[model samples]
Target: MNICVFCSAADLDARYTTPAREFAELIGKGGHALVWGGSDTGLMKVMADGVETAGGRLVGVSVDFLAHKVRPGVDDMVITKDLAERKAELLARADAIVVMVGGTGTLDEATEILELKKHGLHTKPVVLLNTAGFYDGLKEQFQRMEDEGFLPLPLTELVFFAEDGAGALAYLEEQAGIQG
Candidate 1:
């Protein structure tokens, strides 16, 4: 499977970065490829390094203006004309999506993926790694949306949440029908 991971670009904390690396390593060792933003900083770099270290394939998607930020040594890369195109390419190439600890950009990406799934545009599994309660607020917001009847369906039906990388991978395996 080609897993797309949305994560922070600023390496502000090790709490998030460490888990991101572990997740990436697990993906590589499991013989799964990664589709992610083509940035070399923060969690992106950690993830790319982990995948490369474990001999997993890496497919990066980035805009032309951010070309300099693309990680070196990626197995493949898709350069888009803008952010919208980049997001489309990432979603097109991914079989599943993982939302890691990140900022606004990550939130935007995660929401877009969820929206797509809600609209039946894609059936790919979306997993949120809620490490250290990082996504507690977002989860609450989702609940509020459901309570307000603004969402067509429950958020739980739209995405899955895991406490850690292992849990996330397990959910992915189950959703993707990968045995052991």
Candidate 2:
């Protein structure tokens, strides 16, 4: 499966970085391909490195404007003209998505993917990795949205929550009907 991970571009503390790298390693070890932003910084770089070390295939998507800013050694990349195009490409190429601890950019990607699923645009499984309780507030907001009737309960069910990388991978495998 081609798994897309949305995570922070900023270098966070080891509390978050450690798990992110572990998650990436698990993705590679599980024989899953990775699709992500093409930057070699922060969690993105860690993820790519982990996958590379584990011998997993990688596909990076970057915007044309940031072509000069992308990592140098990416073998497979899809360059888009803009952010919108990049997002589309990411979603289009992913069989599943994992939402990790991140800042606003990560939130934006998560929301966009959720919205797309809510509208019946896609049925891909979306998992949120709640490492160190990083996504507590976001989960609350999602609940509030459902409480306010802004979104239906079933729509909110489209998003899955896991406490760690292993849990996320198990959920994906189950969803894909891949027997262990």
- Best candidate according to TM-score: 1
lDDT: which candidate is best?
1
* Local distance difference test scores for all models: 0.89, 0.88
Candidate 2 structure quality by residue, lDDT tens digits, 1-180: 999999877888999889888988989999999899988888888888898788788899989987775777766898899888899999999999999988888889998999899988998999999999998888888888877888854644679889999899999999999975
lDDT for position 177 in model 1 = 92
Tens-digit lDDT track of model 1 for 10-108 = 876778778878888899999999899989998888988998788799999988999989988788998899988988999999999999988898999
TM-score per candidate = 0.96, 0.95
Pairs in clash, predicted candidate 2: none
In model 1, which range of ten residues has the least summed lDDT? 11-20
The true-versus-predicted C-alpha distance at residue 48 of model 2, in Å, is 0.6
* Model 2 Cα shift for residue 38 (angstroms): 0.9
